[model samples]
Target: MPSKADADAAPPLPEPLRVPVADSHTHLDMQSGTVEEGLAKAASVGVTTVVQVGCDIRGSRWAAETAAAYEGVWATVALHPNEAPRIVHGDPDGWSRQGARQGGGDAALDDALAEIDRLAALPQVRGVGETGLDYFRTGPEGKEAQEKSFRAHIEMAKRHGKALVIHDRDAHNDVLRILKEEGAPERTVFHCYSGDAEMARICAENGYFMSFAGNVTFKNAQPLRDALAVAPLELVLVETDAPYLTPAPYRGRPNAPYLIPLTLRAMAEVKGVSEDVLATAVSANTARAFGY
Candidate 1:
């Protein structure tokens, strides 16, 4: 797991924005704070909608339940690519699906995908990921399994007609290649987009949404900022990816949806637009991405 700063060191919330926006991606289920507290803080700072994304079966279920209970919240369900190989090697029997016991690595993956599919069908689950290539973490032995799982997620998203929220980390080529091979969903978003200007142009050509996270504000993230500059406003969105990737001046601290204004403002600065205009465009793009 990545190191985080002391929670006590978290920065105070920034000023609320004149125009509200949606956090296109977040992990509310992993936060130390209660969902109510997180949502309240977010609303207080003009973040009116949040799409809570899940990276595993348990988290996916929790995301769906949280979305059901919260009016301004929505859910996206999927297993992380790293989680796929773990399911294949770990206790397959440790999990069950539709009252049936899984017996092996493949069985375990199948069961997990089955459960993810079931969760994706839920009314409040508007997306089918946080699923994609992650070469930064997974090794060669796991890559095959990860690709298999990713392809399955692509199919699931299409079947459900929901957004495909991708988690691409150091494997942009494979992520795009697999999406092309399997054919992407109508609404596909590269969550916490880390690609460069060229990749951003490709995404623009494909009509894929690019959801920028706090990392875009880092001093060394010129490539990401370049991507943001080149990406059209209609295809751009903003997020906290919270409890992680807090924006500059507070990079090590825990992040929350309430802190989104900081990232949004940074994006506006990158695109040379007013915050209000950027915020409005981001919110509309987010709604289109998730169909919310």
Candidate 2:
């Protein structure tokens, strides 16, 4: 049962997709509903698969367990860029602000990352990320820690033969530099990819997957649309990034995997292709990207 506010925040289900697809990135643990309910709703609308992304040790553990328990869910493990700084500095303020568990200093950061490394090897864990530089949240003080964590996650992904899922925000140059410096995994993805047409071309050149989310449908998101427009269909992936970035006409509403049709439809319109064609490509691309 949902509270009144929760009920109101949730958008009505969009029309079901004619072709099934996978949500390349999402956070089921962050959403309001139970995993079972969320999966059922998503499957009802042709979102037959999802990759549960973890932002911290606890969330990572939950993601691994949930993926192991669920048939259509895979997991990706890593500390968020903002989260890395908090762990390295023993700053409880950030986690406290988010009402999440507090961690310790540099030692704790190492241990936490170790746990993520362990989780990354899980049979159900298909990727190592949502990790990268985030200049938006953490300031200059946190940059070193974020980079260290990002490099380590990249190694973990490669060592485990898993996809490297990136969370690049306002740090595109640094992110690309680090990936090139450390050698990106064979299957690297830009989760909630936020770059321009040039960056999309760069990703295409590198054979990296660019996953677009619901935000691409925003009125002020023409730049994102422009990136999508140039992104090769073979490299394009779709996601809800659920519980955030709900598609337009429902921007303020709480998002769920079930609402993917709206975002995918909007993407097709932008790409000048039919819905079924985009869906087919995205479905196949997601499978190869995540090794599902």
Candidate 3:
């Protein structure tokens, strides 16, 4: 959920860029503004493409529908790691977050994954993720279910020939282990990349994409910048992960796709390259990752 302090309005849009870029992962559905407003704001600032990511079954369906209705937008379908435990245990509170009913048990998990599989076949759905382990939000009780769901999504992405967008938080080793064991999809991205330079080296060796988000702009995020520095330019991507992880100088304020430039500029500085050069590289990387 978004913080209360940053819920009212969006920040001013940054100056438009000559080179266009794509936001590799975002949850427009969870943001403060309407979908059209969000899209317009992004376009006005030259963030021409967006990949709307879903956190659960209902959200995945909505993402696919939104992609079908809008241009310059794509969808990624998945049952988030935190959301997986709720499905396995039939937890009412967790189900409520996704607007799903309780009592369905393991069958519900199967049904949800089946829907995700169906959605993966859509032309507008280009990735399978925001799916990976979340040790911070989900504890030991939920880890097994999360792993099962992660492996399932991995297979789905491979079968559909789409990118795999991972959401790893404090479970980097496990995430890598699972991917190796399951044979990762052709294009794998670590969304909101939360790893060190060594981890970046590991990803680079494996031909995976590392997507840096607004959090990378924080003064305390030196490790993230370090990771960006070591990442191969061809294997790098950028995203807003909007409505959360707003960039510096606007850390407590709302974030939108329009604000992507703030993070991108920060990334360019860290990588010791001009923003335009980094932007062009990131845009091409995103296109290849999602096949857009």
Candidate 4:
């Protein structure tokens, strides 16, 4: 027999599903011409907002425009590390910052920072990232240089009081270390969260937000499902990270924020919570974190 306290701790059965959601970390800019079509699909499926991410200067500009052009769209700006080399070796004019200081002293990293500044100044810009360490998939680079770039984004986020959408790959320890050393802003989010249950605890302890993508719904995601129990509802967010992680029923289709409902339904089931309650939390937390 269970103790009364143990029995009491178990939540009653979750309420029946109802209500809509917002995809917290989408790539609407990546979706391109489908902005109108995507918005309509999202509304149809109950996704209220889509937070588009910026991967480079072009994407950054498109992000701002997408936010303004659509009713329920917001934007996040940053230079993802996979594209780091481009900022260095690509078009010289592509560097949006002033005076065009090249390499070392200012580092090509500043080009991204410049885009962040420009975009953040816009009312449509809501958050600061798609940034953070990505060593798992990326090849070797000078750690010092990578650290410099990562720390710069954190400092900028702190300065702007904007939330960060970190992309921590196999570099979990390094990512955690940077977040701590740089004193990550009060509201940090792990986009496409891939860490295990222990990382969930760390996220909870730090008040960090976890934005789950379609991967969480995969058949082999038992660890992710287990981690779900460890995080509070308020700390949980849902995203499509679209054109990727299309979720079960819609897997293989080119994903968009519109498909967020599938992911939301799955997450609600995992948490043993009502879809409405979960949707509300995802939307509210997403808006607050992105200042939408």
Candidate 5:
């Protein structure tokens, strides 16, 4: 049996987590602060909406509840890679479907397809992801596992006719290829886009909106900022990916959506647009992708 010490390590902090605007992708249910308290801060700072996505079945249920309870909140449901282990290894009967090879519970992927139908009926369920590849960290074995789950998520999004939210970390080429092969949504957004200028151009051509987080403001992210310069206004969005990618100025703190305005200001400066204009554009694009 494994000890508590055997649990996996935590994700590295994304640096200065202050957000001054809407957090396009966040797990409010997983935050240390109470959901209401987290939202209060967001409201105070002028964040208009929050896309609370799930990492699995239970998390997706939490996403639905958060969306239903909060005025400015919306939700999405899908199985994140980290939680994909349950589908193949656990009790097979747990998930509604079969043939997948999981090593553990059907918690995350078990009811994914079923929940896709159920959650879609919810008034506040907006999109279908926080799903995609994470090859940078996942080795060959893990990457293979993540890909199997990813394919299922893409199919689920199609069945529901919802915009697909993607998470790509260091697997741009693989992600781009798979998206090309399976075809991403006609209205899709690369949440926390980390690709460079060239990839940004490709994304623009393919009609994939690129949502930048606080990292764009960092000195090391000239490429991302430059990508922003080339990407059209209609396809650009901003987010904090809060509790993670904290932008500079307030980099070492716990993040919330209210801090998203700072990112908008930075984006506006880079794009040569007004903060109001940028804010409005981001909101509109978010609605378009989310259908809310």
Candidate 6:
């Protein structure tokens, strides 16, 4: 986790992108500044839109409300994979307890998911997720709950005819298998896509969108860049995943929507396309994936 000083020290904005694009995933509720300030900063740098992603019920509600209040924003609602285990058992560490609704056990988890279901139906809520498996943080004991929640969220997205945003970490096979078994929504996105070239090919074959983030610019992310190289422009999207995954030269610093240009430029290079061309494709792809 980043320190308070690191979170507060914003990076200098890069040159604006010539073609405007959307930051397909972000967490404004976790960032330092007000929503208005973040949007304004992003708009000035050619990031004209963003998707406010929620990790739990409280964040989901905040996301929906913020999206409703702001034209430039859309919301995706879900309980994070780690949050599922916590809701089912308990959050002894309280990592995700901020503004979180109280309760524990099966019934409490169901109630929380029900609220997410209701939020998914909202006009401003364009997606259902940030949900999926996270084997890294969650131990074997929590796998069942995570998969259950993931399947439920998948159904919710399909029922509501919205995009399904997946957060897969060290659980790629399971994520892919579950998506295959559950029959993914028409518009499914791998948020901050962490797969390799082979996985990128699979996603293309299945018509899933791959959303790349600042981490793609890291020195050790050649595999991610390789994935980008093979990913079709139409199936590619870009995001900040703000307050995390800050791009190169600014790694360990706070990320924001305004830094999207840095990542987009990096992606354009990997794809061997002009920034404008890639941005145009991503802008169009985002609207299609999230339905505006």
Worst 10 residues of 1 by lDDT: 92-101
Top candidate on lDDT is 6
Error of 4 at 71 (Å): 2.1
In model 6, the worst 10-residue window by lDDT is 92-101
Model 2 per-residue lDDT tens digits across residues 43-81:
999999999999987888899999999999999999999
Better of 3 and 6 by TM-score: 3
TM-score of each prediction: 0.94, 0.94, 0.95, 0.86, 0.84, 0.95
Residue 11 lDDT, candidate 6, scale 0-100: 93
Q: Backbone collision count in every prediction?
A: 0, 0, 0, 0, 20, 0
Model 1 TM-score, 2 decimals = 0.94
lDDT of 3 at 243: 82
Clashing pairs in 6: none
Give candidate 5's TM-score. 0.84
Q: Tell me the spans in candidate 3 whose CA falls farther than 4 Å from its real position.
A: 1-8, 96-104
Q: Which lDDT values do the candidates have, in the order given?
A: 0.90, 0.91, 0.91, 0.76, 0.75, 0.93
User: How well does model 2 score by local distance difference test?
Assistant: 0.91
Q: Give the local distance difference test score of model 1.
A: 0.90
Model 6: lDDT to the true structure: 0.93
